[model samples]
Target: MKATTVQNTFDDITLWNKMREGDEKSFSILFKRYYDDLVSYGNSLSPDKEKVQDCVQDVFIDVWNYKEKVQSAVVVKAYLLSSVRKRIARLYQRDHIFRKSTSIDAVSFHMEFSVEHELIDDDYATKQKVLHLNNLLNNLPARQKEALYLRYHQGLAVEQIAEMLDINYQSASNLVYRALITLRKEWKGALSLITLLSSGSF
Candidate 1:
């Protein structure tokens, strides 16, 4: 397998195991590989270019800072995606309400799956799933949708979602739970479609 192949499946047990052993090269490779993709993921959640960029940058820094303590990644892509999501959520809570003017809010995101690997043989299936998931997400209730986006897409915690939304932990949990349940219901006919598209399996 190629070097980039390690980044594809969360099940690629060897690469993560190497990174756990204080492997600088391993981590650097991972960071460089995912950087652009994470930025795009962040952009999809909010229209703020600076915040999205900052969010993706912070994710790499945080991962490096915690590398020693990090355990087996629960889907490395999911973990990275969630980290960027939470960072953006924090930026939102800190500035959204009080800011009179900001460039972050003016940014627009086109939810198109950017194909990083031109060589990756099957991309259409993946892109289709991403688009399908984006549409499903757009159908959720605003609060619930934001919470879910911040939590999973941005990889925020319950407390962070609460802080971002100005709600309590329980309320945030409820929103996330409700949102997942709604998606589960809404995605009834599209199970295969979703599994094919996301870094996350449906």
Candidate 2:
């Protein structure tokens, strides 16, 4: 078993080198090896099963496109992680935006009312705040929002999230932390609105 592990590692290193030189078959081998793991990692981030699968497929396609210029340190693992991290982040951000904007009537209603005035109507304010949270989420950069969703909503560990996205754990950690910081800063108003509504003080 130990010998098999060593051999697989050696093969991966060789395949990575070939992939950097534009070898399609090498890329394919790496894809097959990592595909299931990547999908599993993504699924750990969100309950939306289809989105997780799509993100993993997109990650592999991205690696293929950037194969010629992609350089791995020792094996393809890190490169794959980084690639998928970026892809997942973008996917979540896209999803957030679509979910927020899909309801035109809700959006129109929000736009028509004043935030301060809505505070007097508890039920209305609560609904508005929910929409506002979605709005804030939609406005974040694709990468930032995904990092936040995967970390906060999915409850995945940093290492797992990093592995799924093909990023260094530190980098993934930073993305998740930074995204939260940005959200706290940018969406505090919406959060406050929700708090008020929930407390029956709106």
Candidate 3:
């Protein structure tokens, strides 16, 4: 079988194990699978597109170099997300953009939500609603916004989010929970907005 064919047949953990044994095909597959996601997540954490892209590349390079020492990941997506986040944070500190005392929490996270007009019959109303919903999301504290993005946008569980954010489980859960509550309280179309989130339309 072709290397690509064989690589496609295996799951992330299996491919990770293969890469550990010096399988370049497996490493390439993993990098392709998560590159866009890692870039998007990294961009949310840092506004510098060039820096984000560089950090993402650095992450994959590190993974490939240390494949032999890296353990099999139970959740590869979460692992990569955490890795890129830490990479961005370190780069910011090294550039003196962030204080020595700064951590991931000190890094600003920005998320924007878009609603498709086709999802709703009334284009004008949809635009108005989307604007309001976006305002509410932008007003949320940075941590809350990040939590919501990880939970809803990335489909990460609270536990995975906790590990990525380096926060306690309850804190992660509360961040998501409170974010939803605030949105629900402020928006009359909370259900529709939530539907858009759950459906991954935003």
Off by over 4 Å in 3: 1-9, 97-100, 187-192, 199-202
TM-score to true structure, per model: 0.50, 0.44, 0.86
lDDT (Cα, tens digit) per residue for candidate 3, span 1-202: 8766865788989888888899998889999889999999898888899989999999999999998888876688888999999998887778775546667766778756565545555557656876787777878898998888888878899999999889899999999999999888756653466676665443
* Top-lDDT candidate index: 3
- Name the lDDT value of residue 1 in candidate 2: 65
Error of 2 at 20 (Å): 1.9
Per-residue lDDT for 5 in model 2? 59
Give lDDT: candidate 1, residue 34.
77
In model 3, the Cα lDDT at residue 185 comes to: 72
Instruction: Please report, in order, the local distance difference test score of every candidate based on alpha carbons.
Output: 0.62, 0.57, 0.82
lDDT of 1: 0.62
- Candidates arranged by lDDT, highest first: 3, 1, 2
Strongest candidate by TM-score: 3
Residue pairs in candidate 1 whose N, alpha carbon or C atoms collide under 3 angstroms:
48-104, 82-154, 82-155, 85-154, 86-154
Q: Is candidate 1 or candidate 3 better by TM-score?
A: 3
- Show pairs that collide, candidate 2: 80-166, 81-165, 81-166, 81-167, 82-166, 82-167, 85-165
Q: Supply candidate 2's per-residue lDDT for 122.
A: 57
Once fitted onto the true fold, the runs of candidate 1 whose alpha carbons sit more than 4 angstroms away are 1-13, 97-202
Per-residue lDDT of 106-151 in model 2, one digit per residue for the tens? 1110111123444444566556655675566556655555555445
